[model samples]
Target: PNDALYFGFGKPPILVPKSNAIKRSYSLTWPEEVVGALVFLGSLLAVRGVYALVPFLMALGCAAVTTFLTLKMWRLIRARELSFYRFNLKSAGKLRKAGWAFAIFACCWIGLNAHSGWIRYHEVLGNFAFQKIQVPDELALAQVNPARWLNSTQRENILEGKKHYDAASRVALFVNSEALPKLAWFEYLLGNAEQSIQLLGQAASYQKDESKALSLYYRGAILNRLGRHEEARSSLDQALAERDDLILARQEKGESLWQLGRRDEAVAVWTDAVRRNARLALVNNELAGAARSLGKLEEASAHEKQADQFTPNDPFYQWMLGRRLQALGMSELAEKHLRQAEQLGAGDGMPNER
Candidate 1:
């Protein structure tokens, strides 16, 4: 029949030649993968500085990158063919999985960011709370137990105090007289001797009464520790002038004098110090050594006995006494003290005979 065989459809679809048709393949190249990784890293680095200010934005960026990487990993795992680099998001199931993963990651990132912010807020509040505490209370607490000042909580309070002091200083020309010494003490405890010394000087300059005596004494003590014997002696002399009853200042002054090669003067200073406070083991110990050096054996022996009596349980004192006795040729007494020191875990190793 003349009519051509026709399908139910109005017209048949046109078939193009295979050689003339265009074919497209979607796949990530090695260079593209590397660039993606670099882009992710670069974004993180770029946002790090601003993360604290805009944590939500930072978290969003991170979540987006995480979602992308997760999707890529899912594609890799589900790929049937080897070397599969294309990420397919056309499937409803795959799209839903990606959406859920992104949502979960974003939630976690936001939660973590909120937690970090909360911590920072609490730290700031802690600082403000510490700043509100009365200086006298803090000082009395520190003085009551000097070791307490070295604890973490006290150290944090001190650091916060310093920050507050700095901020206040920017609006004023002078430091608070009472706070100066406390700040110096904080610096000393933190192992910044130079800064402590500088702060003490400021305190001394701010006040010249008996109140400044403590600052002067601390300055002298730190100078002695630093081996600036002349400066320490000068500072201690000023401290004594400010408060004549300062036995500790006298003891430290003698030490500085001894270091400066004025042995007779040092002996005199320590003797006076011991008389002022007979129970002071430190002064007694110093007097004992000074008397021994001056060939006053009887005086040395008396002071040594006094020191031992005052600090009976002190291992360092026992070790020092043993050494002095050993030097004076009292072998039995020396051995006894040395053994006591050893039992108390004082010396680094066995006491050496000198």
Candidate 2:
């Protein structure tokens, strides 16, 4: 693969972000609109009648604009466009059509409206229902190893044992939690969430102990992906309760709460997690994510800053710094860190979206 055209991104359908740092921001900020609405309504009912709908409404309007822009930009990215990265402005007109400026605007908006909507939609439905989510009937989408398609990254578990089946079983027993988040990631690719969940559920049952945490967490994610928040939360809760202080479980639990329209609770969880463990990029990322969800870009940036403070050399932290800077419209600063992030080699776990 030629480094120039290939851009060194791994295989297709895996979807590991060139940088995982963007994912953290993407996951956390998307809730700003809907979560902000919930926050506004929640706050309006509290204390003196000093309403906060101003923030809510402002957040919503911004969310709408950002949403339109994001959809438009997605089209551009899909078409292998986004001309701003070019060295010269010779094709500015064509570039503008790709909505690069709008993409920047949407990224800078940092409301996290997309993720928030998913979180809220799933949380409300799942929590209110208090039932296990139904896995999508389709299995192909559930089995995608988004990271595996990328040739550079290693599987969370390198399968090696007496026989092929034994190796697979061993790997399954001690699979990488970072390998994939949801069965639906595959489902998304395989074009079937239902089957993926069943396969994952079956796989999850085969694992145990700490490994069970990963299985349960991922299964919960599948539930979330399946739009089954309460059940997802239940499974996420099991992961956290079992681990007591597992960072990923904690992050997912907070994510579950955020999705369920429990922004305050989500914030509380991240706040507690951040206070308890400041060095974790995942924790800081989620906290920053929550801050962004509240239309608190400054707070979000600060959280990202704090994340880097604890781990100055961590590539993930650097990637977060770059992502936040990029989200804030500091393109020069963003690129510098983005390039640095590429050098650091963070585990984005996404395949080549292109």
What are the models' TM-scores? 0.50, 0.39
For each candidate in turn, give its C-alpha RMSD to the true structure in angstroms.
Answer: 19.6, 32.6
How far off is model 1, as Cα RMSD? 19.6
lDDT by residue (tens digit), candidate 1, 268-303:
898898788899875776677667766788988998
Residue 327's lDDT in candidate 1: 38
C-alpha local distance difference test of each model: 0.63, 0.50
Candidate achieving the largest lDDT: 1
Name the candidate that leads on TM-score: 1
Which sections of candidate 2 miss by over 4 Å? 1-149, 152-163, 166-196, 203-209, 222-230, 292-301, 311-354
* Local distance difference test, candidate 2: 0.50
* Candidate 2 C-alpha lDDT tens digits along 1-354: 656564565757556567653434453245545654554443332211111112555655554555455554454555543344553212423555335455566576544444343333333332322222232222112223333332321121111111222222233323323222233233333334555556556555655567667767767755665557788788888877667767656665675677788879877887877776777664576676667656789998998778656656655445545544343334554565566656777657322121
